[model samples]
Each structure stands twice: as C-alpha cells, then as structure tokens.
Target: MSSTATTTEAAPTVELSTLPLRGGEKKAEEKAEEYKYAHLLPHFSEDRYPPLEPYKHIDPGHRALKHANPRAFLDSAERVVELTPHLGTDVKGINLANLDSDGRDQLALEVARRGLMVFRDQRDFIDRGPEFYKKWGQHFGRLHVHPTSGHPKGYPEIHLVYRDGNTSFNFEVDDSITTTVWHSDVSYELQPPGLTTFFLLASPPTGGDTLFTSQVSALKKLSPQFVAFLKTLKAIHSGVEQAEFSRAGRRGGIVRRDPVEHVHPVVRKHPVTGEEALYVNRQFTRRIVGLKREESEAILRLLYDHIDKSADNQARVKWEPNTIVLWDNRVTAHSANVDFRHLPDARHGARITPQAERPQPALEGLDLSA
Candidate 1:
C-alpha cells in the first residue's frame, strides 16, 4: 500500500462507551434524569440564528458550463461525464487508491463545481481497506464520527452501512420514519459534514441506486419572494429528536453518544463556490425557528416537496460493486433506494464524512425584500 493509503491490519476494537445504548438497557435512574433536564434545553437557540441579509444570486460560471455542453469542458487526462443538468458527474480513468496529491486536489475542485462525482471500477479501493478510505477523506478535511452509527474498527471515521434481507436493520421502518428520507449527512451537528464519499462493497443485481438532488437548484427554483424569506430563517436540526438509534436497537459499530441538536441557516452559502443552497433537509431539520408550528410545517412541506419531487434537480447513481461516489453534502441531499430489500445482502458500503464549519446564508447585498 502507498503511504497515502491507510490499512486496517492493526484495527483497534471500539470501546463499549462509544457505542449507542441498547433499548431497555438504560437504568430507571437514567430515564428519570433525562426527563428532569430535557426541558431546560430550548427547542432552538436564538444565538445560532442567521442574520437577515439582502438576496442576490451569485451565478458562478460552473452552472452555465453544466448547461452548455459539460462534456466539452473535460480535460484529456480524465473523462468527465455530466449526470444531470444541476448535479452529478462521472469521472473516468483515475484510480482513487493511487491518486497523488495533485490528482486528489484536482478531484476536489471537480466535486466543488459538480455537486456529486462518481468513480467506477474502484476494486482497488476495497482491497486497500478502511485506512485507504480514511486517508482519502483526510485530504479534504477532518473525518466525522457518526454519533449513532460508530466507525469501523481502527479507522474511527468510517461508517459501515450494511443490510441483509433477514435482519430488521433497514433504512426505513415505515413511512413515518423521517431519518430514512432525503437528507444531508449529519445536519444535526453544529459543524455539519461538507463532503461524503461512499464505496460500495456489495450491491444487488438491480436496485440500491442512490439519488442526489442539488440544493442550489432547489433554492433557484423557488419564487424570488420566498427565497428572500428563506434567507432570514434558521432551522433546528436534531439527532436525538429523530431517535433512529433508540428505535432501531443497538447494532454493532453503532456508537451510543448523547443526542445533539443545532440551529443552521435555512439557506447556506457554499464556502468554496460562493453559491447559495437550501440547507434544511427532511431527516434532521425539526422545524424552522421563530415561526408557529403550523406555519413552519406548511413552508417546510413546500420546500421538501420541491427538493424530493423535482426531476430537474436530481441525479441518480446505480451502485455496483467496486464503485465509489463522492458528494458535497453542503450543496446536495441524498436518499438510498431500498427497492432490493427482499434480496439478501442487498447493499453494503462504507462512508466517510468530512467536517465543516457552521452554515451561513448566501445572501448578496441586493435588497430583494422590497
């Protein structure tokens, strides 16, 4: 293995405290304590609210290039195929496991321009183990440690996602489970993940395709008046409120940390591209701050419907073994297609989320409120 890649040969065992607490295992005292202090934590914090700013669209030329023959922009060294009008690109002829510093830097720039990028035939990645994945993730930023789904053995940043037909550990339990719906990865954290990369180890014959939609497109499609309103809003995102870990029971590699919640801008500006994108997601965003519950729900429902139902904003990736997908979580929302649930070992993959700073609205000084 190259120095840039990390191996799992000396993988360490995850500590028991790091795993999520199993159902019915919490003592009565712990339950009593939780009830006592739960009310003290405000539903949302005002300090985290985003400042209202004038609405202005900064059209980075990347979107224009995407519309005007995206393939024509590809360099000779790599074949870049655009997957959708707004998001997703397929990059061919680069081996992820062996990428030098310069190649990795170029790949990052492409992902910034295109919300999501896919690299097919990454069999060498699987052979390199969890360390290889971790190292690649490190190039962008610090790796995120999932609060519920614990990291793989030695590499504390890799989230191991797996499903088998016989087990109850599926993505969605019922239609009511919001966590299984479309969402940006770990939006509940104060510093949500900026980028995520997933490598498929096993994929069923058909199905298990992941869909990604651009938040940039989602924001642009809304009425200008509504976009102005969204700039002044903040939403509460919570991991404990969603309660996926408690409902699903204790599973291996699932860390049992205390639930965390944070307030984030409803519309965020991408740090690198300076593009504005809708930050609220169905899975983690509990409610919009400073609004009546009814009003918030109506507005959120409209935004959610726009994001999930819009075909023009989406790009779909059909997973195959040895395939790798990288997406900018800051600008994209994704959902896994569970159509192959009936098949044993339907889908399996490892993911790494790179840490990012708090989100800020991308409002330019145009005074659109008038």
Candidate 2:
C-alpha cells in the first residue's frame, strides 16, 4: 500500500463538556485502565462455521422447509431482538465539537460497543462522508476496496449510493432498499476494512432497512465445545466479484485487479479490542481452506445455521434522508434490505469511506508468525 503524510496547522483542540477525559497524557492513562481486562481473556473459540451433514435433503413435497418455527433453532429464546428507538425524527446532525465532553465520550463508547450507530439529517452526509469517517478510522487502518460492486468514481475513498427507482423485494415493503445477505464488507482483502460508514441522502418512499449482526454475540451463544473446534479452521474469500468490477476499469484506470482469493481463519481477534469474533459470512466466503469440497460445504452449512438463526444479536436500521451509519466491519456482519423493488421514486444517497485492518489470529497463544 502507498503511504502519504500531509501536515496541517493543528486546530485549537476544543474541550468538549461531556467526556470526563481530555486528549493528551491524562486520556491515555484513563483509557488504559478502562480496557486493561480486555487483553486478558482472549475470545478464541472453534468451528466458527459448521457443516450441513446433520441436515437431510428436503423432500420436494415438503414446502414447509422454507419456513420453520423461528424458535426451532434454539431450545431457549435468548436471541429475540426488539427494535429500539435511537435517533429521533430530527433532521439535523449533532456536531461533536458542540457536544458536552461526556457526550463525546458516550458516543465514542457507544460506537466501540455496538460496532454501529445511526445519525439523522446529517448536514454534511454527502459532502464530507470520507473526511468524517477518517476521524475515527485513521486510528485503525486505511480504507479498502469492495471485493465487488464498488462504485467507479469513488476509488478507495468512498462508494456511490444509489437505489433502483421503483423496485422492492416482494417479501417486504419499502423503497427498493434492503440488505439481504449477511456479510462483512470486503474480507477478501489482505488487510480488510475495519470500519464502514454509509451516509444516506435520499431513501425511497417505502423500504430500506439495514441489518447488523454481532459476531461476538454469535460466538458467545454457541456450545463451548463447538467453539473450540472452530479455532483451527480457515475459509477462503474470493475476489471474482471485485475482480469483475476491475475488469471494467471504471475509474481513471485506478481499479486494478487484486490477486487475493481464498480462505482465512474462521475466527479472528479484533486488533484493538482483543476480542475474538466469527469471521466468515455468506458473502465472499467460498470454502474451508484445507478441506475437500464436500467437507467444506457440509461444515459451512452448519456454521451458517448457527449464525443465521441467531436473530437476537442483530439490530436493524431504517434509513431516511440525510442519515449516516458507521459500523465496525471487523466484528460485525450487515445486510442491506433489498426490498424496495417496486417503488417508482425509490432512491438513496450515499458516500462510503473504506477502512483497513490486519486480521488477528484466533488463538491468542499463537504467535503472529504461526
């Protein structure tokens, strides 16, 4: 990767009122105390994705296989998710500078914990999407490319957001906007994006909701034995899709073909938080690294059920005009609801900034070279 540094006259650092800590030496000490324990218990668990052997071929006559009791996946109802109100109806962005110090800390803390948060009516959502995300993103890594379907003009900085007007998925109603498949953004990259920010400008009149699932929560709910099994596995994520986009050479010949494709550790640690999370997703992940094709399919099926059925660990966001969502792509999976298929005026506005981070090994005991 290319590196560049630009020096700017430092702006006067404003002391916000909400956070108890301020930048410089004191803040570092306080942060250390706050997260000291996270380094102690590494979240290495095994068999992050399982096989499909236990399940049988469904009889063609049994149409009911399409939908089953949501509770059938679990003996207990621990993962039921309820939509909670976060951002209000206001169409104004909250300026972090104007917020109290504690408020700044609270927002920072929330993004760290939730892996994502929403904002309403961001005044600069469209114009400053890349710059705004760089604020927190620079601390992690560089922006990365989407393995597939990244907008041509944006290059590595951001992705263009558009919705097919007058379209909605039949299963749901909304402006033709919905994230259907569960996935982390562009895991095929050697250093995947750590964070992703989506700024919405114009949403269709009806449906456009994004779903986010927690990798940490998914692992925590699994059997400890199965968790242990997943630690040794890795899966391949291919760039056929991203490569296809590069073939088009859409932007100033800047979208070069990437050579990376194949598997990675099924579970990886968060470089910053030191927490282990399930790293495989329905998107890009093609197979288990060293396993036979049949074996890989079976195992992947098992792992998918464990992830897909865990609905309680997910949050869904409905977008409106001038909304922006920022999420940690490392420890979370997201789906854009593609349900706004039928609306004539369905559209969305967006500017996406990429992020970059190296993958951490699943086992803390293993050295980096291992």
Candidate 3:
C-alpha cells in the first residue's frame, strides 16, 4: 500500500431552502418525512473521503485466531484448511453450484463459523452465466444492488468488478478506488449485507491478492472498558449520490431510489452467531454520533489503526481463475491488492451481496466488566 497524505478540510454545506423543487416533486414536509434523518447525512469535502486517517503501519507478527472452531460445525466429508488463525478457511471437495439441500445447510454453518471460505478450481458456476451466479447467491439470501458499480443487463444484484479491454469500469484510472483500504461491503445500507461472495472470472498471473481481517478479533483485543464505551455509541453511514455514479460512466440496472443515510451501532451483533464485533469501518462510517469533532476523529483513528495494524487477525488470499470467496460482512473487513494494474489482462470478477438484518448491539446479557 502507498502512503498519501490526506488534508482535512471543512465539509460542504447544503441548504434545502435554496434548492428549486421540480414539478410533481414531493413538498418539503413530505420529503422531510420520507428522509427523517437527512440532517445526519455526512458532507465530505470535494477532494476528501471520510475517516481521513491513513494506515500508519502494517505489522506482520500478529497471528492469534480468536474463537474459530470450524470442526465443531463441519462434518468429515468437508476438507477444511485454515488460512489463518483469526479468519479465512479454504474448503475443498465441495462444489457450491452443485450442492444438495443438506450440503447447502452444512456450507452455511461452516461459513458462519469460519467467517470466510475459499473454493478454488470451481467450474460449475463459472461456465454458467449471470443468472446461475445470481441463483447461487439467492440460496443464502436476497441479493443487494450496489449504489455505484455496474451490474450485468437484467441483473441488478450482481456487480461486475471487471477491467477487460472493452470494459468501462477500469480500476487503473482512479487512485481513489483502490481496494487496499479496509472495508465491509455496503456498510452504508440501513440493513448492510450479511454475506458477500466474489467469483474471479479472470485474474492476473500474479498480484491482486485480497486481505481479510476478523473484526471479532479486533474488538476482543481492545480493553473491556473501551468495549463497554463503544457499545454506547452509534455512527453515521451515507450512500453514494447518483451523480457520482454517472460521473464514473458505469452501466448497471439503476434502482433510481432515494439516497440513504442511517445510524448504526458501533458494536454490532452477528445475527447468526450472536457474537459481538466492532462495526465501524474506514469506508462508510462518517463519525461517532454526539461526539465532538476532535474527539470523534481521535477515537475513530485509534480503532482504524487497531484494525489495520493487527497482523495476527488477517489472512491473505491470492485470486485464482474460476475461484470463489465468500465472507461474512458482519464479522470481517477486507482489502484488495491493486498490484496488477499495469497488466494488459485486467482483473475481472463478479460480486454478490446477500441481504442482512439491521445492525443491533449485542449487549443483552453479557457482563462487560469481566
């Protein structure tokens, strides 16, 4: 990852009173009712992205895996290879596209326990087109439409992360779009994705490996006092504007829905596992609600640093052609390596996001002070 200095600037202000209302547009009162939390939306400076602190260091010595027990849920037929102690497992001998009802149930249980599962040398889903890919994701839950990325025609649920010769969404063109920045997919949504699966159609011969980290491990490493304090906080997440999508000139089935902004707990519970994880990420979490600007910046920076610097909590997966990687968004954060940008055969892949329940803090019965 490259180090670039980010300067802090005042956020741009928007005045609803000065904007002209179009014909047939809802009245101000109706619009207010529709978007009741519009005032909480984050405003970024033209040249800046939120959570401004960059990763200070990448430590390689962190190798502790917390609460990972795949054998407890997986049976003998499933071959599980642990990629790292903290997160990521490579499952062999099972084809996702050809899974039976019993196999599907067992796979889901393994994924929830492992946080991420990688399957290499897969041909069943790759040979089929977008529809087959969509079907595989729907087995888990409803697919989510990305606010900015392009999807295949008639398929709003699939986002194409391609860079073929004729592709419009080129990864090399923009420095702002690198995947090295750690984030959970679509954390901006009111109900963020429960799971995200990526299938690599074409990958470079070398480079473009992705890094996955466990947020469950991240929270566990923090002091109990700080964890208790984090449970009491919420953070704001805002969606990408339509104009931003237009400027990129990427094509997909646009939903044309109103922009979204919402508040979510800083510490969120995994709906399936019932475990607590630190939820605020570098990508979409704007600020800690009700905190002073300076205080919010300081605390957010500290948390981001902890997530990034904890080398023991991450696993690196190199992409292979016809490979599929599925991760639980509620428990993990990932970063993609952009080292293959100069290669003529650009990396191409498809991503599917499974719908998730709204985030809630897991503080019902646990003793925080222990």
Q: Could you say which candidate leads in lDDT?
A: 1
* Model 1 steric clash pairs: 6-131, 19-255, 19-256, 20-255, 20-256
Q: RMSD of model 3, in Å?
A: 14.0
Cα lDDT tens digits, model 2, 1-370, are 0001111111111122211112222432343243321111111111112211121211111222233431132222223233432211111336432333334334433444457766554554344444554453333344443332323222334444333332211112233343366778767666666545565434445565677778888877878888787787777786665455434432111223444664567888765456678888876788876678999899888877777777777776766545566667777887766555454432433334444445666865533221
**Which TM-score value belongs to model 3?**
0.73
Query: What tens-digit string does per-residue lDDT give for candidate 3 at 274-344?
Result: 77899887867788888899999999999999998999989888665557888888888887676665655
What lDDT tens digits, residue by residue, belong to model 1 across residues 175-233? 55332368898788766776678775444566667888899998999899989989988
- CA deviation > 4 Å runs, candidate 1: 1-78, 168-171, 175-180, 242-244, 247-255, 364-370
Between candidates 1 and 2, the TM-score winner: 1
Off by over 4 Å in 3: 1-78, 164-179, 241-255, 364-370
Ranking by lDDT: 1, 3, 2
TM-score of each: 0.75, 0.63, 0.73
Cα RMSD, each candidate: 11.0, 18.5, 14.0
